[model samples]
Target: MEHEDPLVTAEWLKENITAPDVRVVDATWFPPFLNMEKTGRQAWSEGHIPGSVYFDIDAIKAGGTDLPHMLPDPVMFSSRVRKLGIGDGNRIIVYDQFKFFASARVWWMLRVMGQKDVKVLDGGLQAWIDAGGELEDLPPVPVERHFTARVRSDLVKDANQVLAASEAGSHTIIDSRSPERFSGDAPEPREGLPSGHIPGSICQPSGELRTPDDRLKSADELRTLFADPMAPTISTCGSGVSAAVTALALARLGNWDVAVYDGSWTEWASDSSRPIAKGAA
Candidate 1:
C-alpha cells in the first residue's frame, strides 16, 4: 500500500486535528549529550497540541540492545502503540518539539511497521505556534485499540548489512552526521567512541535538507540535493536519530529504495574492527 506524502503543514494540521480517525502525536526527543534542560516528555507535559499523545522513542525502543532507541520487534511495537490508542485505521500526524528531529524517526518506525497513513508535521511544534495553533496542558485520555504490526524488513539495516552495502559496491551509504564529526575532526558526543564515518560513505548532514524555519525543502530542491537518483541508499547518523531525517527527505523525493542503519555511527565507531573513513566522507 502507498503512504501519504511524508509531511503536513501546520495550517493543514490545525484544520484536521479534530477528525475522528486522525491521531496527532508529539514524538519529541532529545539526546542527553545535547544538554537540553527540558526533555520531550517535559515539554509535552507543559503544553502540547490539543488531543495529541506523546510517543517516547527512548521508552518504546527494543529493550535488549545496547544501542539507543533501536527498533523494537513487531510484537512490542504493536503492543505499545496500541496502548497509545493508535490502530490500523488511524491517520497519524507526528511532530517533535525541535525542528523535524525525532518525529521522522517515529514516522519511519510506523512505516516499517506497516502503517501507511502516517505523516510528519512539516515545521513541527514551533511551526504550530508560529501558525497560531492552540495548545493545552491536559493530556488526552487514552482509549485502548488493537494495532497490527507486520514488520517490513527492507526498510531497516544493521551494522553488518551496512558494512556489506559499503563493500558490495551497489548501495550508497549516506552519513548524516555533521562534516566535522564525519571527518574525525570533532569528538563524538558519546564518550569513548571514535569520530569518523564508515568507509566509502558520503556526508550529507541532515540539517542541510531543511530550511531556515526548519521545515524541509521542496521536492525539486531535494532532487538537486541528492543529485544521484539511481543509487539505493543506507542512511546513518551518530545514533540512528538524524538518519531518519535523510530517510524522510529521500521518501519525499519518492525514493523508497532506502534503508536506515538502525545502529548508525554509535555502533560502527564503537567497534574497533570496523573500517573508519575520515576527511570528507
Candidate 2:
C-alpha cells in the first residue's frame, strides 16, 4: 500500500492552497499549564490559512472517557472530519501554532483512522508565516463531504500492552517527556499525577528530535537518533500528545511498527498498581 509523505513544506502548501482535493487544517492547541489567552478556535477566527478548517484536538476526543483527548471511535471520527469537509480522498495538511507540539497528534490520529493522505506542516504555522504565506481571518464555508474511518489498531496502544512490553522486554518503550519530568524531578503538568516514567522505558524528549526552528532533522540524523532500527517502539508522553512527535519522527525514518500509549504518564502514574521508575531508565 502506498502512503503519504507524512510531512509537507510551507512552499508546497502555499502553492497548492487552492487545490480542490487539498484541505488545510489548523490543529493548534496548548496544554492546560500554558494558559494561553486564545483558544484554538479563537486563533483560527483571528487568522488562519485561506481555506483551512480548525481541528480541535481536545474537542473531538472519545466521549465517556475521562482521559484527555483520547482517540474517538471510528464512527465519531468519521463524523467529525466529514463535518470539516474532509472526505476519504482529500489530501489533508495539518499545522499547529505551537511549533511541533499538537500537529503531529492530529497527523497520527488521521493516519491511524485510515486516512493515509494526511501530512503535518513542517515547522507548523510559524513556518508558513516565515515563508511569507498569507493568513485569512474569515472562515471558509465548508461543503459537506463523506468520510470513512477504518481504525489501524497497530498505531495505538493501551496501558495493558505497555505493561506487557515493559515486562517482556521484547519492545522498546520510549518516553518523550522532558528529562526532568522523566526523572521525577519536575512536576507533571497535570495536577495530582506523580512524576516519573514507566519501568524499562528510555527517554527521548520530543523537542530533541526537532531543530531550533521546529523543523524535523534530516533522515541521517533521525537514523542516528534512533539507533535500534528494528525494535518495535511504543511511545509515551505527559498525556499522549508529545508522544505523537516521537511516533512521527520514527515514521519519517520508515519505521511503521511503532505505537503510542494513549493514556501515557497520566494514566500510568494514576494507578499505583503499575510499576514506575525514577531517575534514569
Candidate 3:
C-alpha cells in the first residue's frame, strides 16, 4: 500500500471538524490498570468530540475466542461497521485517551477491512484538551455508514511467523513493552504470563512515542525510533494491545508496512515450548 502521512492535529481538527465526509472515531481502549474495569466508557460519556462516533474495540469485534479482541469475520465486521454509519469514501480519523493506545487497533482494523483513507489524530485527547479544544456532552448521531472488509493477511503475523522472523532477522520486531517488562525484571501485568521478550525483538516502549501533552512526537523523532530497514518490520506487546500504539506511531511517520502481532507476547509466552530470551535482544 502507498501510505501517506494523513494526521490531523488538534488544531487541524478544530479548524475543519465540520468538513464533509471527515469522520472522527474515538477508538479508546485501556488495560486493567486505568481501571479499564470502569472509566474508559464513563469518561467518554462525560465528554467527547461532537459528531465523533465511539469506535469501541471491545465491542464490534470478533470476540468469541479467548484471543483478545481479535478481528471479526469479514462479513460480520462489514455489518458492524455499517452500523457505525462509516462508508467507503469517508476520511476516517482515530483517537484515544491512553496516549496512542487502541486508536491503532481501529486503524489496523480499517486497513484489514480494506479502508485505506483512514488517519490518526496526532496527540489524541490529552493534546486536544491542552490545546483548549471544545468538547461535546452528547455523542453524535452519525448517519449509517457502509464499509467493506479488505483482509490483509500479509499485514498480520502470528507467533510462529514471529518466531521464524526472530531467528532469521528478516524483519525488525519492536516490542512496545516497558523497559522493565522487556528486561524480564518485572513480571507481565497479566497474571501467570512469563517474563522477557521474543528473541531478536527490540524494546521500544510505546510511551516514547508521546509528547508532554500526550500527542504523538514529530515525524523525524518517530523515524529515528524504528530505524530498521528489514522486511516485514513489525511490533508486538502483551496480548497485542500496546503494540498497536507502536503501530500508530509508525503510521504517523508514514511507516504503514509495519503490522501488529495479533497473538503478541501473550500468546508467545503462553506456550512454554517457545524459545525465550532474557536481558536484551
For 1-281, candidate 3 gives per-residue lDDT tens digits of: 23666567888888877889888888877776545655666667778877778877777666667767777778988887777778888888888877667887788878867888887788788778877888887977778877767788777788888988988898899998888888899988778898899988899998888777777778778778777533467789887767877877776666676888987887898899998888965
Residue-level lDDT of model 2, residues 1-281, one tens digit each, is 22444688999998998888999999988887889998878988888878989999899899887889999999999899899999878988999888667889998898889988888899988899999998889888889899988889999999998999999997899999999999999999888888988989999999899998999887788888787845899999988899999988888888766899998998899999998899976
Q: Which regions in candidate 3 have their CA more than 4 angstroms from the true location?
A: 229-231
Question: Which model scores highest in lDDT?
Answer: 1
**Clashes per prediction?**
0, 0, 8
The runs of at least 3 residues in candidate 1 whose Cα sits more than 4 Å from the true structure, single-residue gaps closed, are: 1-4
Superior candidate under lDDT, 1 versus 3 = 1
Candidate closest to the true structure, highest TM-score: 1
Q: Summing lDDT over every window of 10 consecutive residues in candidate 3, give the lowest-scoring window.
A: 32-41
Scored by lDDT, model 2 comes in at 0.88
Clashing pairs in 1: none
**Ordered list by TM-score, greatest first:** 1, 2, 3
TM-score of each: 0.97, 0.96, 0.92
For candidate 3, what is the lDDT?
0.79
Query: Better model by TM-score, 1 or 3?
Result: 1
Note the Cα lDDT for every prediction shown: 0.89, 0.88, 0.79
